[model samples]
Target: MKTEIIWMIIGMGAVTYIPRMLPFVLFRGKELPIFLQGVLKNVPFATLGALIFPGILLIQEDIWYGILGAGAAFLTAYLGANVIVVVLSSIAVLTLYSYFV
Candidate 1:
């Protein structure tokens, strides 16, 4: 059992390390193409979309609630509301939805 656990840890570590290390190692001292750079510049937004899109549409089995919550967040963000305000608004919306729905 101990040996199996050790191997599992080692395997997981390797899997995690390779992806984390590859960009630094591979991109180091290299000038990427302009299109590639543009794409890379948008990587953060793309990643955010990937992380937020799926579950952002489904909260408490009501997809519209999630959409409204996201819209509130976006509006707060656009209006320069601080992080606390944005988060509080989202929580307030969801909480009110829970109680009323």
Candidate 2:
């Protein structure tokens, strides 16, 4: 509600928005090479792995908890489930593990 907070939010929005817009603006009407396009298509998966792998490894309460969750997610993803399904399947598996154990 404060003026400073409003300006800060606007500035942060612009900072994040500009980079996202740049790729579309710069690449519009330009064809990327097939190999580059393929690599770019996998970027999100790579980023998600990088973010989640550490948490999976570092779970302190019980290592099997992380391992089982990751295993479920990996299997779901390997079977070509959507990303949301992969996440939900992992949660479902972990919930069952907790309930039964």
Candidate 3:
């Protein structure tokens, strides 16, 4: 049982690592097309929105909490902040909301 679990873990790791690493290995020197580059550049923002939108709609206690955080995230992202900064700003807004309300 333990050996099977270990093998499963190894398989999962390889499944994840290969797709990520394969691109770098295969496209080391090539420049992707401009259209593709533009699309790729927006991937993080799109991903963040996809992940957060559902949570915003699903907040049980008060929708205000989700609204505040989402607004902060949107504003920061619009200002071209890093994804980490956008997330942290949203967290800061929510933390403040929790503290006061």
> Runs in model 1 with CA error above 4 Å?
1-3
What ranges in model 2 sit over 4 Å off? 29-45, 59-61, 79-84
What is candidate 3's CA lDDT for residue 45?
Answer: 98
- Residues 1-101 of candidate 3 have per-residue lDDT tens digits of 69999999999999999998997888853398888888888999999779877877566578788778878988999999999999899889888989998
State each model's CA lDDT, in order.
Answer: 0.87, 0.89, 0.86
Instruction: Report the lDDT tens digits of candidate 2 across residue range 8-78.
Output: 99999999999989998899633899888888899999998799988985674888899999899889999
Candidate 1 least-lDDT 10 residues: 54-63
- Candidate 3 residue 9 Cα shift, in angstroms, is 0.6
RMSD to native, candidate 3: 4.0
Q: Each prediction's TM-score against the native?
A: 0.74, 0.66, 0.57
Prediction 2 TM-score vs. true: 0.66
Q: What local lDDT does model 3 show for residue 89?
A: 92
Candidate 2 — worst ten consecutive residues by lDDT sum?
Answer: 24-33
Highest lDDT against the true fold, candidate: 2
**Which candidate leads the pack in TM-score?**
1
State how far residue 33 of model 2 sits from its true place (Å): 7.0
